[model samples]
Target: MDLRPARAHEAGLLTELALESKGYWDYDEAFLAACRDELTLIPADVERRRTTVAEEDGRVLGFTTLDGIPPEGALGMMFIAPGAIGRGIGRRLFEHTAAKARRLGFARLTIDADPNAEPFYRAMGAVRIGETPSGSIPGRVLPLMEYVLTPR
Candidate 1:
């Protein structure tokens, strides 16, 4: 798959992909609707947050966003298309995000991951630091993880 920066006009497409990816975990409509805005990829964020897309043959397979200031930032978003999950796309996107974080001088990347994705992040070398409240669901919490960029 090819990894490249996301384009401005592709915001809607990316947002749909994120929602679909999230729904892959079997979340109900109400739950997904509640998370829509929080999962959206705004055009401005494309450049500001360093959004990246993974594609192949001109088809978007996955995407990730590296957010916040250097030396510490959030893996703001990482989603693989429902059809593309389990084919190593998520892993590739995670590695690409981490590499970009390191290049931007980030010493660590924080992740507020869905319970379903916690194991994946852990497999990618992130450790669960605690829990964080969901931006959309008031009573929901997610695994808060940290990935160190500096070499061991």
Candidate 2:
């Protein structure tokens, strides 16, 4: 797969990929509904943040977004198409995001990860720091993790 910056016009396609990837967990309709707004990605977002897509055979298989700068950078979004899961697509996108963050001078990267995605982040070298209230689900807590980029 090739990792490249997301194009302005591919926002809608990326958004669809995000929703479909999320749905892969088989959450109830109400849960998905609550998370809709947070999952939606628009053209403006593409222009505002550092976003990249994993493409192969002219098809986007996954994507990730990075927000903020040094000492405060965050993995804002990451999703892999349902059909592309378990083929190392997510890992490639994540490593790319981390490398980009380092190049941008970030000392670390933070992640507010979904419960189902905690393991992936952990395997990517993120350590649990705490929990934060979910932006979409009432009374839900999300894992807060950090991947330190600077050497000790």
Candidate 3:
């Protein structure tokens, strides 16, 4: 798979990917709805953040959005096409995002992850800091974690 920064043409596909990702949290309809803004905001938000796309055979397979440089970091979004999961696309995206974070002088990378995705982040070296209520759920919550990297 080839990974590169996202371009204007991929905006619609990225929106689709974001919706598909929201579907994974079946128990939380509110969470999905709350994410509506992100789906619409990403393309425009690229002006201030790092957005990368993963492609294989000229097809978009996944994407990752970095909110800011590491240390004071955040992952605005990370989604892989349903058909492309478990093939290392997400890891490559994380590595790419992390490398950029390091270069930008971030010392820690954080993600407010979907509960189902906590394991993957753990494998990537993110230690759970705490859990916070889901944006859409009145009482449901998910893990917040961070991966600490050496200073650049």
Candidate 4:
């Protein structure tokens, strides 16, 4: 798999990838529509933030985005094509985001992990800092996990 900086022309593909992971995010049809809107903006946002894509055979398979370097670099929107799940893409993305954070002098990478994704983040060395109650999402809560890379 080749990991490269995501270019601006890839938003449509990334949107598809995001929708492909609906099962993992636990987003219903209504929720997914909203999420899709956000995902579609990723390519444009990449021009302003750090966004990387993982591809193989010239096809986009996954992506990871970083926001606001640490003391706080958010590990936001790490998604792998649904067909590519369990193939180590998520791990690679996590490592990429972590390394980027370190390079930027961040001491922590945090995530508000969707419930189904909590275990994956835990396995990636993020500790459950706390739980964020359903803020905007009705009937759904998320765990706020923090991967401490250095003493705060």
Best by TM-score: 1
Best-to-worst ranking by lDDT: 1, 2, 3, 4
Which one wins on lDDT?
1
Better candidate number, 3 or 4, judged by lDDT = 3
For candidate 2, write residues 1-152 as lDDT tens digits: 79999998999998889888989999888988888898888898996788999999999999999999676889999999999999999999998889888888889888999889999999999999999898898899999999888643
Check candidate 1 and list the clashing pairs. none
Off by over 4 Å in 1: none
> What is the clash tally of candidate 4?
0
Tens-digit lDDT track of model 4 for 1-152: 99898888887777677778755556678787655655564456875668889999999999888888457778877888888999999999888878878878888887878788889999999999887764446666689999987532
Q: After superposition, how far is residue 11 of candidate 1 from its true place, in Å?
A: 0.4
lDDT, residue 15, candidate 3: 84
C-alpha lDDT of candidate 3 relative to the true structure:
0.80
My TM-score estimates for the predictions, one after another, are 0.97, 0.96, 0.87, 0.87
lDDT value, candidate 4, whole model: 0.79
**Tens digit of lDDT per residue, candidate 3, span 1-152?**
89888886667778878788668657366657776765664456654667898988998888988887445888778988877888999999998888888888788877888888999999998999998776655677779898887754
Reference-based lDDT, each prediction: 0.93, 0.91, 0.80, 0.79
lDDT of 2 at 60: 96
lDDT of 4 at 92: 91
Residue range 1-152, candidate 1, lDDT tens digits? 89999998899999999999999999999999999999998888899989999999999999999999988899999999998899998998998889878888899999999999999999999999999999999999999999999753
Worst 10 residues of 2 by lDDT: 143-152
